[model samples]
Target: MRKILVVEDEDAIREVVALNLRLAGYEVTEAASAEQALAVFSPSAGFDVAVLDIMLPGMNGFSLCETIRRDSASIGIIMLSAKTLETDKIKGLSIGADDYMTKPFSVSELLARVEALVRRVGRQGASSAAPEPDGRMVSGVFVLDQKSRVLYKNGTPIDLTQVEFQIMELFFANPGVALVREKILEGVWGENYFGDVKIVDVNIRRLRMKIEDEPSAPKHILTVWGYGYRWNA
Candidate 1:
């Protein structure tokens, strides 16, 4: 069974989320705060997803997400917030979350995002274990090592989140193709995803920070204004 951690301070909301997740057949663990989560979360425990609320009493969800992500890049993270501001969404994604959902969201939507994240995490994990017959794909200064799931830039390995890694895979596979935002979204987040399409934009921004010489003026991951983005390599 896939394991999930749900950290929400509100009892009712947490209970509802946990109940639905359990009913959906996930191995669910609940925490009322980030402190509680810290006590229980273990990378080796093999948690596939973490659903964290931003308004915790202490050590907010953003911090918890960062801590967990620093330890396990493969684990999928989803952030919850009552605020729908684009900056909040960007900050959450920049920190480490693979997905974000604002409050007043339906349980069904949350479940769908969790399901999509879990599938992505599983697929990425499986792919990392086996080396492709052609081990690496070289693009300028970048070297994507399929077996280790690591991207090397000029001999230095650039750390990539699971989502960013998948995006890189898609870009490398379709070089010079002007991929629309929806196509990128479906390619990385899967077709069953229920989150906003802007997620593609946020993740691309984050990925550029890691890979590009200057994120403010990206050269490789060029934006095709009025449409989408294309990998220049």
Candidate 2:
């Protein structure tokens, strides 16, 4: 069974989320505060996913999510927020949120997202090699190792969130090819997404920070003005 950690301040929403997740066959763990949530989370705790509320009594979900990312990128995180603004979603993605959902969302959609996140993580875990075009891809001194799901810069390992890894892999697959916003959305995330696409920009920018030698003037991943992003081989 997949273990899920739910951190929400509201009692009712937290209970509902936990109940629904349990019904879906997930082992659910709940936390009302960010501190408590972190206190409970460990690298070997065996949690497959984390469903976090953006708002909390202390430290907030964004910080909590970042902390978790710093520890492990293998685990999935879905940020839940009542704030529906594009900036809010961007912020969540910038800090390593794998998926974003606004408040008052359908339970079905939420469940689907949770399942998708889990499945995506599972695929990454199962793949002994990078799932990209023509074996593995490399640029400069950086190498994207498919089998291990690791990025090495100058022979040193680089830590990347799951979303960042996917973006990098996408770029590696289509080097120098301009990928449109819709294509990226459909590729990285599944279909039927009605949320803001600006989150893609946010995530791409964040991904650049890690993979690019200079984020200000990116060399590998370049934004194609009005088109989209291109990976320069």
Candidate 3:
């Protein structure tokens, strides 16, 4: 059975979210704040997903999300924020969230995202070894291990979120393909994904920050003006 951690301070909101998730057949653990969330968190606890509210008592959700992401790359993270600012959403994604939702969001949509993220995270942990010939692919200074779902630059491992790794997989597979944003969205987030297309750009920016020496003038992931992005190996 899949397990979920829902962290929200408001009693009504937390109860509603938890009840809905439970009705959907997911075993959920509830936490009122960041501290409570941490107390319930265990690296060995095998939590498949965490829903964090951006505003929380003491440690904020951003801080908690970072800590959880840093600890386990395979665990799926979704951030909840009432703030509708683009920057806030970007900040959540930049820090490590796989998805972000605004308040009054559809319960159905959140459940769908959680399900999609579970599949993604499952893919990363599907295999343990890569003895296959095509399991490892090299693109310029970076080597992406498909089996391990990890990227290394000059032999040093680079941390990647589940979505980021999938994006890298697509990019490395087609080094100079000049894939359009829609293609990227389909490849990474699937055809039925319910979200804005600009998420591709946000993730691409995050990748540049990690893999490129200068993110402002990226040497690898190049923009194609009005088209999309092409991986420059």
Q: Give the Cα error of residue 137 in candidate 3, in Å.
A: 1.9
What TM-score, computed on C-alpha atoms, does each candidate reach? Answer: 0.94, 0.89, 0.92
Q: How does residue 110 of candidate 3 score in lDDT? A: 91
Give the top-scoring candidate (lDDT): 1
Q: Candidate 2 residues 1-233, lDDT tens each?
A: 99999999999999998999999999999999999999899989988899999989979899998999888888889999999887888788888888899888888888888887787677663332344574455765777776677888888888776667777777777777899987877666656655567768888898788878899999878999997999885
Alpha-carbon shift of residue 39 in model 3 (angstroms): 0.9
Q: Model 3 residue 185 lDDT?
A: 89
Superior by lDDT: candidate 1 or candidate 3: 1
Candidate 3 local distance difference test against the native: 0.87
Per-residue CA lDDT of candidate 3, range 1-233, in tens? 88999999999999998999899889999999999999989879899999999999999999999999888887889999999999999898888888899998998899898888777777663332332487787778888877677899999999888888888888876778899999988877778778778888888988999999899999899999999999998
Q: Candidate 3: RMSD over Cα atoms?
A: 2.6
Which wins on TM-score, candidate 1 or candidate 2?
1
Model 3 worst lDDT window (10 residues): 123-132
Model 3 steric clash total:
0
Encode model 1's per-residue lDDT on 46-109: one tens digit a residue. 8999999999998999999999999888999999999989999989988899999999999998
